[model samples]
Target: MTPFEPDRSEDLLNRLKQDDKQAYEKIYFTFSKELLYAAYKKTGDRVIAEELVQNIFISLWEKRQDLQINNLQAYLFGALKLSVINHIRSLVMENKYMEYQMLTYSENHQDTANLVDLHDLSSIIEEGINSLPEKTQEVFRLSRYQHQSTKDIATGLNITEKAVEYHITRSIKRIKEYIKNFYIFL
Candidate 1:
């Protein structure tokens, strides 16, 4: 109720663990919008922000039975920070891909500035993407390169959205694995 209400967060959390709707609603009302805003600030995409917030709440609920909270705000802020960091990391990888694409575009006209380095990097990345399963590679290109929505891709490919999602997820996992293996040499 009030800001100074002592142990109120704990009580609400306890009630939430007991599957109390009113307590859950209260917690949602008190924190959801702010958390969404924080996630949106980091992601700069409403869809991703909504997913991030939903996941945070779902994870919180799953851990509720054994959850401990010394400071609700601190715990929330920490989660937000981790979500933001993951968002930034994805953005970086996306940007790197965009850079490669732009380089390819410029190559058609004879622009060769930093050509060797760009070619080497692009070759490595291409090998990584190529090593993925054909479905994963197609899904990754459609989603990451062509910037198509999952629904659109699934529709265009005449496949189920869940299958498209699975392919994309597999591609991401393979990419991470590639990066890990490549990093070992460095």
Candidate 2:
């Protein structure tokens, strides 16, 4: 690879600021590989390094009009270092979160893989509701499923609004208790 000549890089950056395509290509050819290798040395990941380099160039291009890059290499390396550090820190945090979640799952007793089907769970819940006394079922369906206001349902059913409120609250508490134990296992 040809060494990056500072004079040429400065002239190219100036011309690229004026929207010259040739200058842009010359800059890309001269600096892309060196910047990639520099970033990769810090990141140890080709994909992340490549992405950082790409972002740096795009940022440079966007700010070309106001850029005063006395030393192109220094400016590029500074940008590369910042980008790589940010990427690595994020990766470290993500790995820590995954490790913690794995450990939490292992300590729980239930076999997550043997959990009942979600569809079956829903069917079982509906069947249980259907088996309730007729009055409780009507109040449960109106408040929970149909989303009717208790006051409106009480007016329509000619019962006290307190009775409607009591039935909905009890049904919701029962559903919550049932799901809580199952979810902890998962």
Candidate 3:
């Protein structure tokens, strides 16, 4: 592939800002492969790398009018870096939640029937939690599993108490809805 000329890149950016599909397509075709490669190198997962690259392009299109990108390559790479970091952080949190659940279940349950029921319920709850948005999942795990207070979560996450409360409430509502839907399907 030929390198994008500085003048051509500026023109493409201008056309992209005006919602030109061809310009967007050109940008995607130009940078997507490299972005995917970088993401894959960082994540070691082809599916996740492709997803992250796709999200970056989608965001670029969605926010074209509002973006002020003097260096598109740098911006895209930076976004990829942050996305990988967030993904890793999310995986860590999920592993912690699973470990906590396993410990709690093993320590408290002895009867076979109780164990079966608990396993089913735990699976349902885990699915519900996984369906939540990343920040909400984090907030819910911190609040419920770690037993952190709202104030503490807010402080730790660098958000206001109100935001922490909002996330907790939203997570609970969504998880309840998920559980309800799951039972209805059963």
Candidate 4:
């Protein structure tokens, strides 16, 4: 047997296809740092990036039997890019889902006071709002239930305009999260 050349990725690929553990470790050691850094740069979270890298490499190993890659690094990076894109999309998907839920709840609520009065759901929403931190809950109620302007809320709360906006955004996110959980019960 000729001596193995670590510089030749084709040789590594061949060895990997044969389920050679050492070759797998070599590839992982060679590329894991770069892959991790790439994932982190895109994700902004070390734990998530690390998990993404691990999952990608695990998939590579699992599919080694039939995998044909002329450039393994490129293949892995492509997979990572897709993973990051999907991950980022999932956040938007969550917000979109929350909007859809709120819309559905409102429409159904308005359409059928006779069938199912929204008082019960309103109570749930109220509960979600009440669960917010005191200042946040107060700020949200003033903005939403009271229809007060941001300036009014800020002046009343003795906080800055930006702080009021931040509180409102935080409250909305928390309320949406709570309602999503409440929806599971329904």
Candidate 1 local accuracy as lDDT?
0.74
**Candidate 2, position 102, lDDT:** 67
Computed on alpha carbons, the lDDT of every model, listed in order, comes to 0.74, 0.72, 0.80, 0.78
Model 2, 98-132: lDDT tens digits are 57656666544324522543555576567667666
Clashes of each: 0, 0, 0, 0
Please, what are the lDDT tens digits per residue for candidate 4 over residues 1-186? 123344578988999999998988888887888889999999999867876787677778889999978777778789899989877886787688667756776665746742453576677688888888999988988998899998998898889986786677667667766666765665
If ranked by TM-score, best first, what sequence of candidates would result?
3, 4, 2, 1
Candidates ranked by lDDT = 3, 4, 1, 2
- Residue 96, model 1: lDDT of 82
User: Global lDDT for candidate 2?
Assistant: 0.72
Q: Which candidate comes out best when scored by lDDT? A: 3
Q: What TM-score does model 2 achieve against the real structure?
A: 0.51
- Please provide, for model 1 over 81-163, each residue's C-alpha lDDT reduced to its tens digit, 9 standing for 90 to 100: 89778878867876886677577656644356447546755776778889988878888899999999999999988998857
Prediction RMSDs, each to the true structure: 7.7, 21.3, 14.8, 14.8
In model 2, which regions exceed 4 Å deviation?
Answer: 1-3, 103-186
Report the Cα lDDT for candidate 4.
0.78
Which ten contiguous residues of candidate 3 have the minimum total lDDT? 105-114
Q: How big is the positional error of residue 6 in model 4, measured in Å on the Cα after superposition?
A: 9.3
Identify the candidate with maximal TM-score: 3
